[model samples]
Target: MITRHLTDISSKGFKVHEISGAVDTLHNHNRRDYYKIVLVTGDMILTYGDQTIEINGTILFFANPRVPHTVVHRSKEKKGYACLFTEAFIAGRERAEILQSSPLFRTDANPVIPVNSEQAAFLGSLYREMLSVHRSDYDYRNQLLRSCVELIIHEALKIQPSPNGLQQKNAATRITHLFMELLERQFPVESTGDPLRLRTAQDFAGALSVHVNYLNRAVKGFTGKPTSVHIAERIAAEAKALLQHSNWSIADIAYGLGFEYPTYFNNYFKRVTGATPKSFRKRKV
Candidate 1:
């Protein structure tokens, strides 16, 4: 299995990473450590192990980091900015709470969210400003980056669409809460290299000590999707992240995501994403 390279920064918090190059292949990522905000300025394909999202022009949101995924640019050339931050960067648990509570943090059913031109411009400008401040040797770089992150989220909320449809009180209280909490605790891999250990409905069901069928029923009754569907969706979300954010090869990605054979992972990924992993990564490149 392939593991992503972790970059360390001072306690003050890191700046940001903005790379301009060939569309890179995605490695499997089944862990969660950092928060990512992406703004793509060109044609690109985003792949989560079993899902593929195409972006022509706009901003996308990926809050959870526990899934394994990757990204590919369809055109030969693409431009984008990605901002990565940790919970500490948010100052304290209080501030991080805002991020977790916000609807924007919802990465399960929908990971990549589209923004209007104006909203995109605002986010892009904020990220660009952070990148600029990051490059300069300043006394308060951490403070600046922190402020920029807050600003970016603020703008995101301003443009975020309001949640629609009737709300289900029971689902909101019992099943939904448990599902989200369980889902979050299993990111960035807790035990071994096995993806199953980190991202599976069965593992969650076992932890909860409920039959997989019961768990599935609860999740389905609430979210309209089966338990396996939710798990696969989250896994796919991570796949898209590694594909876009890292440079690991497809085989490495497969291994990292816990596939005993790359071929098995490849077929599974294509089935879910509607494109071959190589072709998906190639589009990004």
Candidate 2:
């Protein structure tokens, strides 16, 4: 099964489907490169990260692109709705930050949240409204849909507490967490033209408003790797994904990954993976 990217959806950048309608096509175990929200009314099991969550009755779940998860439909008659959208679709919207900061989207946070029947009905209706707008040709449908998405996020926030609300004992751990979140927010590479903006440890440190040396120490102390190493590894991972999934040429891929020239990217890829991008793609094929 392939990871679903934002471009896989409609040109409008959003789509909603009944869970039962899409279950057969959904991957058994896979990751997605867009945000997802599912409102369900039946029993099922979800393998999210390292934990297995069993849901009975109504539940609302939010998924971030960085987390890999799988859904196991236990009941023959499951009823729910799921919607997917790219970050760009909700960019500049007020609730965008909620998606990033909320417990529902945190990697370590428990994303599966149980809800009462009344709450479930409210959320299910929101999804139904989104589906309706998705099918219409209204000129302002996208704006309305964005509002719907914001409403869903706000509703979920009211139910689930923010995981970050707890105080961390160590400053290094908190800094590392913030750094990782910033790094992940830039990912999935929506377009070959949208090259990665932050490619260095200094770039991240500056964005985080911390000294470069301090950033290095914090990341290294927490993750046992230098900050630059983490940046390079993430970039390399994205490079491999593009090489395997997209039709972009090596030169284009190089530029899209923030390399000054194709040669630099080739050397970096070889250093990290022991295979040039071209060879890697060929082997995958």
Candidate 3:
């Protein structure tokens, strides 16, 4: 398959590599003790598990250490910066809260936030400061790293989503927030081989330790869609992404997605996409 490449550096429990130029390769980088926060200018495609988001002039977060992903530069020339830090670099529990409470730990949204001119300046300054400490022979590198990250989060919180979009969130909306967290955690994994990985409400209910009927009721009440439909939609979305972007064949895609047979996958893809996987991939090509 034509996958992006990943460059991993985890020596000293954490490391950072600054990147520039078009994203061409498909690969992954893994670190046992670190998470990655990327601030980029220009444009690129980021594939995190099953979701691939188009990003430009944005700050994005990747929280899970187990999931494999890659960033591909779409242009002949691209520029960006990335920092990988271990939890140890964060030091105190308060710093950990910054990551957990923020949308960085959540996977539901595409999670790409645009940077305003002012925010961009702030981020650039923070990154420069962090780089300075990283390169310097200073004795307080850890303290400087922690402080720079704090500044980064402060700047990120200043960003406001578009007014015309999702309403402003409040703590009063607790159930929905919890529901979104649960949904995001499960949505990307719904497909086992690809024909619809999560085929039943009970499957999710079991995972969440709730009654199947209650799960169905909550999902339907909140989203106006039944649990099964939501699961199907998520699987279909992932199917389309694999078809469009990867070089895997239709049968291989079906198997990768969890379909038992190519025929079943073809039928399901046609049902949702109004085109077979082959046709859809061809069109994208």
Candidate 4:
């Protein structure tokens, strides 16, 4: 299997690379154990979760471990810098990795930010400086790198679109948010040997310590969709991504997606998308 697990790449806690010609070799980016930030200028399409984002100019892109993303590079001129860091690399003196709550990396927030020439120049300069400082013999290089990461976040915030006025969330809304988080945490199906653990609304309710009925009501009330629909939709999305991007066989993909049999998986796929796995993969190819 082609997987980019954090254990294999977190030896130094972080790495910075100059991106050019094409994107990273790996397409399964849901490493769920580290974070990624990239700044690039290009014309391409970014498949982020169930949404597709178009890229034309310089943009600062923030990617978390929670979601799976694929980039279809369309411009050979695309060149910039990418920084990959483990939580241990950025852990604060007194706090854990608080990026889990950062608006820039949130799953629902915009991960792509278009930058003007001036902003891109400054961010690109930081990446270059980080490259130099990271490979130097300076004793405090790590500290400097962490500070640069912070500066990038602060800079992105300056251009981040302001959210609506804050209002206190009701209990239902809070519960619904928790459900969504829990749901998203078990995604990207990295391994065919490891199937999904939570596949039903009842399972989610058990994990949340709430009655299944209550969970269903809260989710439907907040999102106007049933809990089961959300779970299936996410699963179907991952299935499509795996079929399109991985070389795994259909049976392995079915097993990875928690199907008891290939027939079951085919039926589910057809029901959700009106296409069999074979046809879907063929079309994607």
Q: Give the worst 10-residue stretch by lDDT in candidate 1.
A: 1-10
Clash count, candidate 1: 35
lDDT of 3 by residue, 1-285 (tens): 111112323445445556675465543554434566777776667775555678766554544453446767655655556677665556477676665544444323234567877776777777777777777889988777777777766556557354333432221122233444444554443333433334556765553334577566666766788877776677688778877776677777787666788999899889876888878888785
Compared with the true structure, all predictions reach lDDT values of 0.63, 0.75, 0.60, 0.78
Better of 1 and 3 by TM-score: 1
What is the Å distance of residue 149 in model 2 from its true position? 0.9
Q: Quick one: ranking by lDDT, best first?
A: 4, 2, 1, 3
Model 2 lDDT per residue over 256-281, tens place = 88898999999999998899998999
TM-score of candidate 2 against the unseen true structure: 0.60
Model 4 segments more than 4 A misplaced: 1-8, 22-28, 93-101, 164-220, 223-285
Error of 4 at 81 (Å): 0.3
Candidate 1 ranges with C-alpha deviation above 4 Å: 1-5, 9-13, 25-31, 49-51, 166-285
Output the number of the TM-score-best candidate: 2
Task: Give each model's clash number.
Answer: 35, 0, 17, 0
Query: Would you give me the overall lDDT of model 1?
Result: 0.63
Q: In what order do the candidates fall by TM-score, top score first? A: 2, 4, 1, 3
